[model samples]
Target: MIKVKVSLRPIVSKINLPTVVKTTILPGDSIESLFIATQVGEIFYIGNGGIRTFLDIRPRIIKLGGSSGGYDERGLLGLAFHPEFYYNGLFYLHYSVAGTQGPVAFSESFKPNPCDPKTLNQRWINRETQYDHIDTVEEWSLQSNGQPQKRRTLLNLRRPFLNHNGVNSLNFSPETGKLVLTTGDGGAAYDPFNLSQDNMEIAGKIIEMDVVKNTFINNPPVVTRFNELPAPIQETLTVMAKGVRNIPGISFQRFYNQYIKYVGNVGQDLVESIFSFVHYKPIPVTQLVQASLMNSEPNQEGFVNFGWRGWEGGFPTSTKGGCSENPTLDEKTIAYYNEAVNTSVSRLKPLTSYFHKDQRPDKFGGTALTGVQAYMGNGIPDLTGSVVFSDLARVEESRSPVRGVLAYTRVRTDGKLNDFSVIETDYNFGSQSAYYVSLGTNLDQTKLYLGVYGSMKVTDCNQGTVFEIVP
Candidate 1:
């Protein structure tokens, strides 16, 4: 399997460098935190408690300030933490905004009136909340005198692509804790006046909500708003499953003790995925609405169609079947032919893919799988149920076997996806003065006690570093 067409070059060559250490759990105050989505718009919260104490790390922005708040696409993209998050402080975000002045065509439906005027086939829905701010789901609380207690939006999005406001990721359901949203495919390319494969009312899918049903006006015409809050806690978006295309990441795979699994991440343009949310566990929803209203094929149930615009990750549009190795077929398993052409749109065969093709000149911007973390490290004894992934590196080029560092695993408890290793490779570490190595456990057991908060540049400023990954 060595078919060559090589032209990908970006070499500095230095290999094997993993032994970092510069720990900060609450030192000088920095309770380990780092979540970013920055083109610079704003979704910043570097570390340590508020009243502003950023000794330095570049992003401290988190807006909602006057003039009805502002921050266009606003930078910050996605971050999630709330399985119970101790006791519900719940968090979820996705940005990009600045379109109320009105008139911005490309529609099949978008009537909210900015002055109304859109045409991709007619689009201008905003009457105030055609979907509102791409996507927002908040429920914060920490004001014992510590700030941050006024964030309650719980699902809001009306974004028609300023750049795929397909929201990013928010996963929860360690077993019916209920909350899984990975939307995208509501934009980019087409669905133009069709509002994403025949509008089910709101853009491109992968939604499932019920963080404990806030009644949502008793699910009114598909949940509108529950008596404007104060009905217990209010939160409901129950749409369980739907066709996906830009699901940055959504996860859950426990494997022992009553087994629970659901994982997703697909973004076609060269086929990219991780899927196995068991197509919403073995069928039957009136056979997925009689295969979406009186048969049209594509195995209905919960939905998992990884092939968009004819095929990307599964190849075919020809750049040599989208990226080489042609001769008909040579990879085998394309997620079992993207669930048999997403449950019967017919014409199977196209799942297991991992092609590189000179690493990103364009193929919908290279191997996408932005973020995935599931390694509950108490300090890795017998490797305490492993799973670690973060590939936010979108082709800075370097033969991309996943640029920079971090990729680990253990997956097996029936959801099967095996060991495959890389442990951790350096991304600089806390050096530049103050960022240095070895902390927490050791004496023999290999080594483990890693907890690192990220972002570093130093001299020109882009700081914030909390480290430790000893061995």
Candidate 2:
């Protein structure tokens, strides 16, 4: 890793919290334009020498930051343009639907006790009445008149808790030419229901939907599992991987003729991990449902699994507690010992991982992985061909003004864990907290974008600024 320092040039300011940032050309445009999607359900594009509203779906978004005490993960979380958007005028969105909030799956915060078997194997029952909210994925098109309108509904997912419904969730897969949706392990801490490893659970999995297939179901049923979906919808989806805790989004980097996929799995308690792989086999949702009905195991050869609930990054998932004998030392108990062994061989190894608490002077402790993208731009030569990522905030003890971290790492050719180097930024935030909420790139990934917020709360309006990482 090389020491890299860059400048943050502010492009847009006074916006709501940005959850997704990317670039796409409008139907009639000749050049690519930057688009920013806010958590409060507004999409703006930099065009005509000013920030213009591309779409506003606030009325359709669930009321945010009320129940969560000024902070929330439920809102407009994902936005993506079609691969052929220049000709098709198609795009997709994933957001928490308005008027669908319900009782949480668990009445209290969840922490698995390894000594108590009941806590370790709890199931999510009474799902219909016990759920947090519903997230909907839909296809929208920019009409000939230059107005965006909903084309059809793709998926209506029932989420168990308020968090872990991924940020920057919707993306178009270049390899398969399908729309990819990456979601979290239905939110409660430590995955109380163990949904990630379950074959039927829709949460905690990377799914690819073939948008070309017209299922004709304009309004899909709101369901938590794959078995509950209509057969037509099931036929169009394939599961790329499972055992995800929470993900920022998936990024694809061109490597010769193939694409290298990079995914950042937000840590549970210990570490934040970024995994890269060039090959995978996706299993159709239909086959998984049929296998469950027949009580047979579907062939999982070439499948990708991150091993959540059992393994977090490169270590076994553990619960941390202060040591009784030593007041300063923390004790960690393996949360799921049995699970760690079962999935050890099948799960994919992370390309790089950074700790929540690091003692190294050169590394900063990570709070949460906000975004990850591969930068192919030559503008910053040191960061060229590297995977760049952002953290919500660095864990600097007793720091007055909290600041987020920007770092880069490279994939190893030997399939082993690699280290990351922090990319120092020259921009100063002064007294305000700057939480890096999201990261994005242009159509060709030759440019990088950073979304910074002054506050962590969604209720804090007009505190966001989108910047470009420049030399």
Candidate 3:
């Protein structure tokens, strides 16, 4: 048996709604690089035990103080460093914004005229009833010693409803130097618009773009609903794969000849899971894959679709059913999804998934399952090959018991994942509330860091925190 013990140790403290965090160490760096994305829309750079403003986009983030109040999904959601960040100083952030104009369309409906409540009941939703947001990816470049300048827009997606827009997660291929991004099927229960299954829309799929060129490495995803949508929007998205659900974080596992990417996807009600996509170079070498050329774009390689909204189980054999957490499962839709599962040409099952069963811990109710990462750091021998992940449960309000999870799975082979287990389950931080949202490897890939969105909030001091998982 592969034995391991997990503990959370504080690294960076007092952050605001800490959501996405990343760390890196280059060959020429004197100090390790630590960067974090806050739900309130600020990316901070920490080093030598201090926090510095890497970039403050708070002014642009759209946070609607409604019935949900401070608890929200809108804000900066993802952060990533260019593969060559050390030399290029380029990075990207995923965030949400209010539409400057009125409602754009049905898929992304909205008219933010709070100043004039008279202009209401415009469309399918009332301005007061729904607060809409547009998810955006902005690229920025940091010079030798100056402010991080916004380079250009990489992705802008329209998000309807309040939550479940999916937790935006971004990472660059260690081997190919390409950007791999996972987006939640557009929000609203049952995916009312059916966007997750629609390939034409980038709303519910995994997309790959050539960040340097700011263009898709390939054409728009050839999804089932290709013919339904307007040709213009169809041509806009560059999908890498389809049938993806809510994925909050992803981690890379690389060997001498193989580059494997793992993404932890959250299920509706019954289960939560982790899936992987692998890319292999034709010729295996001692070193990693050589940055290759592709169809008119840089490093444009393809990946197999890890089926979502339809399929599950490389371990449980095969699991199926409803798309959302909604209790009612449409017979027709369920049948169609089962058919798709049987006939899917490119469906890949999950690495592991935990079901809500009797005798399971209350925390097993994964209202939100966020990150899945294999421990590749050499610092801890026991964790070297272990797959680590996190969960954010909405059912656990700030006061009832504890919140979320930060756990790991044991990988059995080079490809498949079997044992679904937990590393740390006891969570009680006293006046300091403990919740897990983001998981990442710091510089040198030796330590695992967990982003804490909340820990008891004391007067004059906010308890947003980020922690390192030590074995």
Top lDDT hit: 2
Each candidate: RMSD:
22.2, 1.2, 9.2
The TM-score values for the models, in the order shown, are 0.28, 0.98, 0.75
Candidate 2: which pairs clash?
A: none
Per-residue lDDT tens digits for candidate 3, residues 52-115, read 8878887887744332534565667778888777788888777777442223234433322223
Ranking of predictions according to TM-score: 2, 3, 1
Candidate with best TM-score = 2
Model 1 scores a C-alpha lDDT of 0.37
- The per-residue C-alpha lDDT of model 2 at residue 11 equals 98
Ten-residue stretch with the least lDDT total in model 1: 10-19
Please identify model 2 stretches exceeding 4 Å from their true place. 322-329
Predicted candidate 1 versus true structure: per-residue lDDT over 388-469, tens digit per residue: 4433333445342333223444545465444334343434333332211111222121222332222211111233232234
TM-score of 2: 0.98
Per-residue lDDT of 230 in model 1: 33
Q: Rank the candidate models, highest lDDT first.
A: 2, 3, 1
- What TM-score does candidate 1 reach? 0.28
Ranked by TM-score, the better of candidates 1 and 3 is 3
lDDT against true structure, model 3: 0.59
